[model samples]
Target chain A: AQSVSQHNHHVILSEAASLELGCNYSYGGTVNLFWYVQYPGQHLQLLLKYFSGDPLVKGIKGFEAEFIKSKFSFNLRKPSVQWSDTAEYFCAVEAAGNKLTFGGGTRVLVKP
Target chain B: DTAVSQTPKYLVTQMGNDKSIKCEQNLGHDTMYWYKQDSKKFLKIMFSYNNKELIINETVPNRFSPKSPDKAHLNLHINSLELGDSAVYFCASSRVTDRFGTEAFFGQGTRLTVV
Candidate 1:
């Protein structure tokens, strides 16, 4: 069974601060990576994804992730964050068709 | 318009009762899934159905049954619910073909609370 690990369970950052959330997965096959964010009282929305192509993929709200197959990591990064960016972020991977394995989410608290 | 939707966004029930969470997707996707997010926000896949056929059944208990009436809907029925079943359930849909760059879209999640 494939498993995902998120090193940061909770992250606190001030506005305009750079951010990096570590994510690692245990899968040897071809894997698809994704980053989903959920604001307070809002549904989960896609931040970014990596299927095939460039190792670094950009997403909404100035977020991006680099898929490193050798290290089995897909870490989410942002140059600067806003107060509105405070939300729970989830890292998920799909080795099979549509079934996804999600990591323990990291709650980001961006203070202004 | 919302791509995926779930009914009874907040469900409060007693233990030993039966409950159902209905989900519908208008994206015309062929695959749908059920995921449970625990109190700690750990999301796990419970079941997956493709074209109304069972595909992925994770380590979920037998009490949780997913019924897909068609390709656009996948409803989860829980029998003999327990306190451990109290969690937020999310419904998601995606294209069945291993299409690159296509990610599953999730619903507003039904928060189920069992007493």
Candidate 2:
């Protein structure tokens, strides 16, 4: 079974600070990666995704993730963050089927 | 308009009770899935149905069953719920196409609290 690991469990940052969340997965075959975010009371929404081709994938809200096959990592990064960026972020990987294995989410708290 | 929706957004029940959460997707996707978000906010896949057929069934207990009457609807029924079953359940749907890799759209989630 494939598994995902998120090194950061919680992150705290001030407004305008750069943010990065580490994500790694264990899968040898071709994989699809995704980053999903959930606000305080909102449903989970897709932040970004990496299917194939370019390793760097840009997503909504100025967020991006780079897929490094050698490292088995797809880390989410943002040049700058706002107070509204505070949310729980999840990293998910799909190997063959439609089933997505998600990592333990990382909670981000941004101070304005 | 909500793409994917789950009924009874919040459910509170007692142990040993039976409960069902309904999920419907207006996106007309071919695959639907049920994921359980635990207290620690770890999302785990429970069941997945593709085109009204059961495709993926994780190590979830037999007490929990997923029924898909059609491609757009997948309902989960839990029998003899326990305290450990208290968690947020999310329903998601995706279109499986060969050309493009699709992403799953998640529902608002049903918060199940068992006493």
Candidate 3:
């Protein structure tokens, strides 16, 4: 069984502020990590993913995440966030068998 | 064009009613999945199908059955829906890899409300 834990349940920030969402997973063997964001009324879209090779992965909208294998963490970061960045972010992990287990999610509110 | 789409974006039904949610993906991926998002925004996998074959089925109730007619379509049917079944159901597709899919594409999600 695999599980994902998102440290923050909700986050509030103003425009131009730095944002980081912590995510940790419990799984043995190789794993694939991903970050997905769901805006107000939109579907879940892939923000970034880490399969192999590079530890740092860049995503759309100036977002990025670093997969720290030692820490078992894949944290999402944005150097500076905009009002449009307000949304619910989810961290998912797939250890094997094409099953993706998701975290509780972090709701981010960016004020203009 | 929408890569992944689910029909009945919003479904409001009553207890004891049987309902179904349809999902379709045009990306030609080999695997499709159904996930449920609860009130607390916790997402959990319900089922997964690869090439129209059931690959994974989580420990959900027997009332919930997933049907994959083809590689591109995966449908979920719930019999005798309960209040607990009210949640957003999302469909996703991906190409299966050795460990898993490299990336999964998700649908808009069907907000199911049982009143």
The deviation in Å at residue A75 for candidate 2 is 8.7
Model 2 C-alpha lDDT per residue in residues B27-81, reported as the tens digit of each score: 8888888989754344767888889999889899999999999899999999999
Stretches of model 3 off by over 4 angstroms after superposition: B1-115
Give Cα distance to truth, residue B87, candidate 1, Å.
21
What fraction of the reference interface contacts is present in each model, in order? 0.00, 0.00, 0.00
Q: Which pairs clash (backbone N, Cα, C closer than 3 Å) in model 2?
A: none
DockQ of structure 3:
0.04
Question: Could you tell me the TM-score of chain B in model 3?
Answer: 0.93
Q: Worst lDDT window (10 residues) for model 1 chain A?
A: A96-105
Q: Give candidate 2 misplaced runs (Cα > 4 Å).
A: A1-75, A78-112, B97-99
lDDT by candidate, in order shown? 0.83, 0.84, 0.83
Q: Which TM-score value belongs to model 2? A: 0.55
When only the first chain is scored, the TM-scores of the models are 0.97, 0.98, 0.98
State the lDDT of candidate 3 residue by residue for A10-87, as single tens digits.
Answer: 788889999999999998679888898866533466788888999999999999999999899999999999988877
Here, model 1's chain A TM-score works out at 0.97
lDDT (tens digit, per residue) of candidate 2 on A1-112: 7888999877889999999999999989999888998665344667888888999999999999999999999999999999889877889887763346677678788888
Grade the docking of candidate 1: incorrect
